[model samples]
Target: MTKETKKYNKWIVILSITIPLVVAILFGVKIDAELPVFLPPIYASINALTSIVLIASFWAIKNKKVKLHENLMKTAIIFSVVFLVLYVAYHMTSNSTKFGGEGNLRIVYFIILISHIILSIAVIPFVLITYVRAITNNIELHKKIAKFTFPLWLYVAISGVVVYLMISPYY
Candidate 1:
């Protein structure tokens, strides 16, 4: 890695660890306040939008529309950040919503939820590294990592919406 690329490695490591830890700590905090809106649906919609953007990004890159791909990928990242903020805000203000689902559906919901949660955490570093590679003009390395990052991220985005949809009725 060039010095420029190497410099970002520390930031990527810091963010990759800090983000999940901060989110986990924040999940334990509750603030007594009435939010102006119901956030679950909003965040869920953001997740859905992120998925669309990710697909668009893929299509753009496949077509050699590099600028378009860059923009779409950035949008997807922004949507994800917005979703996280809103999700954390919602959780801080409201109580947890239990899944009213039972039997096979309940099992299925948990399975999706578990996988989604795991992948969401796991994708952080992949995303950061892939992004760094791209910004540093390390196209070949970026492409290799992005193959894994793209699917992992797309799954997380899609499954977030699915989890929200499955649990929304109880909220």
Candidate 2:
């Protein structure tokens, strides 16, 4: 492996541990009152924005606008970070929302919800690896992994919004 690829090993290690620990801590922590009530809608909009940015970035890259794609990806990452912070903040201050959907839609909801949950966890390392590759000037590996990363990240982002919609009524 090239030095660029080797350099990313640290990031891979850091993210591998950081993400699951963060998830575990956040998941274990519970909140009682709903202070800072604006977090839900804000994070939901961030999720939607992340999805839009990801699609737009794909289009930019397809048109050979590398710089545009870079900017879009950076923006998408920023939005995702903001969404995560807001999500954690909201969760830290409010109770989890209960799903209210019923009947056939419940199945649909659960599928999306489950996939989103799983992908959300899976995408953490993918996102870190993909970005590390790019930043390390390992374009070949970056492109290879980006194809995998994009859809997973996009799905996670889009589903965050869907989950909010499905559960917001109970909140």
Q: Kindly list the per-residue Cα lDDT of model 1 for residues 1-171, writing each as its tens digit.
A: 688877899999999999999999999999999999989989999999999999999999999999999999999999999999999999898889999999999999999999999999999999999999999999999999999999999999999999999998887
lDDT values for all models: 0.95, 0.86
lDDT of prediction 1: 0.95
Tens digits of per-residue lDDT for model 2 on 1-171?
777677677778887788767966996687776674678888899999999999999999999998999899999989988887777878777767777888988888899899998888789889888888777777888999999999999989999899889877877
Total backbone collisions for each predicted model: 0, 0
- List candidate 2 segments past 4 Å from native: 31-34
Error of 2 at 167 (Å): 1.5
What TM-score would every model get versus the actual structure?
0.99, 0.90
Q: Which segments of model 1 are wrong by more than 4 Å?
A: none
Q: Worst ten-residue run, lDDT, model 2?
A: 28-37
